[model samples]
Target chain A: QQPVQSPQAVILREGEDAVINCSSSKALYSVHWYRQKHGEAPVFLMILLKGGEQKGHDKISASFNEKKQQSSLYLTASQLSYSGTYFCGSRKTGANSKLTFGKGITLSVRP
Target chain B: EAGVVQSPRYKIIEKKQPVAFWCNPISGHNTLYWYLQNLGQGPELLIRYENEEAVDDSQLPKDRFSAERLKGVDSTLKIQPAELGDSAVYLCASSATGELFFGEGSRLTVL
Candidate 1:
């Protein structure tokens, strides 16, 4: 099933912080985050597996809460390069299936 | 050394015409995925191939779209009698174990 993302769009100034949340109705084994600039393919960001784990990039981090069936992405001290669409994908256990994605959140970072 | 490769970075065709996009996945990658992204929207999975076998193609519009990955190295997605709504970016991605690497994508504009 496709996951759900909150705050469809957000505008931030440089050095600001923002959070995007994703929730799935079904249990998820892992969640992956990606970002895509206009006219480009999505780029892999980080992955959070079950067991309430977290993973991150340079200034971006994400946490997965198995009990809540949710994950949240945190962008700290955002940069202009962070302006893009963000998507969260989840893979359920027992299926060995491909990741299902949520509607992306559009983030615009301004100077 | 290289990411997923896609050919014909941009294509323009009239409605009802035929178009095809090709992809070459990373070496030793076992999984290949095709996704479609409409303007201002997130990517939606079209199909997934494990080696040369398509394991998940439920989201594909089989009536107008068809895909094949014959040798487990390269894949092609074709659209016949394309419609105006089919104008979007076609992204090809590959994965070795879990993480995905994306191509620049082929942008198709149907007139």
Candidate 2:
């Protein structure tokens, strides 16, 4: 089943912060985050494993709560380049694991 | 290294016509996936291949949609007697472990 994302859209000024959350009904072994610019392919952001580790890149970070089957992406001091659609893909524990994605959240960072 | 490669970035066809899209995954990647993305939405998985084996294709519209990843490196997705609702972006991604690398998708417009 597909994951559910909160806040379908968000607009923020430069240097602002935003959070996107993804929740799955089933237990998740891993969560993957991606960002897609308009008319472009989705770019890999980061992956959080079941260990519940928090990962970061630049001003972006994410936390995974395996017990709750939820993940949250954090963008701090957002940049204009941060404008895009964000997606979270979840993988369940088992053989032949496949990534199921959420509908997505649009994030617009303005100058 | 080159990321996933997809051909014919844009295609237009009348309803009832057949359309096909192709993808070549990243070198040495054992997993390939096909996804469909509607405008303003996140990608939905159509099929997933582990090596040459299609481990998960439960989401694919089997009646009119078919896919193959022969030799485990290249893949093709086909839609026969396409309908207007089939217009969407087809995205191809590959992964060695689990973090996917995507290609610029093939956009299909069925009129």
- The i-RMS of candidate 2 is 1.7
Candidate 1 is graded, for docking, as medium
Model 1 Cα lDDT, one tens digit per residue, B8-68: 8999999999999999999999899999877776678999999999999999999999999
DockQ of 1: 0.63
Chain A TM-score of model 2 versus the true structure?
0.96
lDDT (tens digit, per residue) of candidate 2 on B6-39: 9889999999999999999999999999999999
TM-score of each: 0.95, 0.96
lDDT of each: 0.91, 0.93
Q: What DockQ values do the models have?
A: 0.63, 0.73
Model 1 lDDT tens row, A9-91: 99999999999999999989899899988877889998888999888789999999999999999999999999999999899
True contacts recovered per prediction? 0.61, 0.78
- Cα displacement (Å) at residue B99, model 2: 0.6
